[model samples]
Target: MKKINLNSEIEELNPEELDHIEQALLSRAQTISKLAYAPYSNFNVGAAVLLENGEVLQSSNQENVSYPVGTCAERILLGYAGANYPNSTPVMLAIVAQRAGEETWASVSPCGMCRQAINETENRYQRPITILILCANGNVLRVKGISALLPLKFDDLNS
Candidate 1:
């Protein structure tokens, strides 16, 4: 057996430091969070995917009576992208979450399932998707690719 080490780089940024596209994607995610249907958890989440063709798609968390049936913002965005823009490749993704009755939002990481979905997106496109995680308190985190988030990713059964 061989020992392997994996590492990732995460960049902390201020809101004002974001570039034009980054700002747009992050702002859209925040804006979409307000539309989430999270009556049970009250944790509204939003995600925005920027395609290589310059199209930005936004989605919000959709909840169901049975919590297990609910879907996350990341999956919703990915589903929409797969159905609507099958040929287009995603270049970046921005995510934000806000709790009910909270004035400030917090940076929310993608769920394990969503992380796998993001990794699959990168595999499908054969390109990296820049991730911009934004917090309402003005903290921002950037990951170069999903690999940075999920280093030991699951590709297939026959590894």
Candidate 2:
């Protein structure tokens, strides 16, 4: 048996150090959360993905009445990116999630489907997607790449 050590990096930003672009991403995510259609769960989620060509996408969770048909914020943003900007590779992704009537933010992890989609995006682009997740109090959790969040990943390119 082999041991695979995995580590993650997060830069806790002091308000003054928040970059303009990242700040905007976080802002968009927060705003998008308001538009989430989460009547059943009442948990709103938002996502912002930055492209290399200076395009940043902001999307909110869209809930379905049937429950199972609804998609997560990450998948929504990724789908939008794939449809509108097929050639652009995602450079960064920022996520913000909140519960109903809650004034605080909670860290949202990408689901398995989103992980596969992210892996496909990374493989297609041949690059990494930096992630900057935030809590309402302004604590930032940053990950350098999508692969960092998804280990033991299986893909055609790697096979």
Candidate 3:
């Protein structure tokens, strides 16, 4: 029998430790979270991406009456980036969420589908994308790439 282990590292950082670009990304994510269409779950989420071309793009979750038809902020942002700046690689991604009518920010991670989407993006660009997650207690969680979050990711079948 063989045994295998999988590990992931998440760096907990004080919000003040973030550099200007990271701070701006998180701030934009926080601000855009308020615009999410989450009438069903009331859990609004926002995502911001930094492209190698020096463009920052942001998106908020869009919910539909049928839950499965809804789109996550991360996927939406990735789609826009791929469509608008296909040649530019995404260097970083910041995600933040809050409950509707709540003043406190909630700690949230990307869903499985979104993680896969991020992994595909990384593979497409042939580069890693740093992820910043806003914690509930005003801290930030840093992850180097989508592989950390989705270790056993699905690869391109065409490859």
Candidate 4:
């Protein structure tokens, strides 16, 4: 048997390293976290998607009485982007979360479903989606693509 190695780099965000657009995307995610409708869990999550065309869209988690009916911020943002800007490729994604009564915001990683959704988008658009996770520690985690987050991802049976 051959050995396989999977490696991913998670870097702390350096203010000087980020460009204007990256900074703005992170800020949008932080701002949207305040508006999440999470009455049940009180864990508000926010996400921002930056399109290849330079358009940035933000969304907050929407909770529902039926837990399964609710959606995550990442899915909401991606769904909206796919619906409205079908032709545009997603350039980057940023995520942040905060508790209902908490002043500190934490970096929330994408759920398994969201990771697959992101992988689908990347394969469909033929572009890598950079991900920025804003942490409560006042640092950000930077990842280049979905593969970094979800190694050995599920590909179709045809593959």
Choose the strongest candidate by lDDT: 3
Deviation from native of the Cα of residue 68 in model 4, angstroms: 1.4
Which residue pairs collide in model 4, if any?
Answer: none
RMSD of model 4, in Å? 1.4
Error of 1 at 143 (Å): 0.4
Worst 10 residues of 2 by lDDT: 7-16
lDDT of 4 by residue, 71-127 (tens): 999998998999999999999999999999989886578999899999988888988
Candidate 2 ranges with C-alpha deviation above 4 Å: none
lDDT by residue for model 1 (1-159), tens: 998988899999988889998999988998999999999999999999999899999999999999899999999899899889999999999999999889898768998999999998888888988999986568799999998889999978788
Please give the lDDT score for candidate 3: 0.95
Candidate 4 off by > 4 Å: 1-3
Measured with C-alpha atoms, the lDDT of residue 67 in candidate 3 is 86
* Candidate 2 structure lDDT: 0.85
Residue runs of model 1 more than 4 Å from their true location after superposition? 1-4
lDDT of each: 0.92, 0.85, 0.95, 0.90
Cα deviation at 119, candidate 1, in Å, is 0.5
Alpha-carbon error at 104 in model 4, in Å?
0.9
Candidate 1 lDDT score at position 62: 96
Clashes of 2: 0
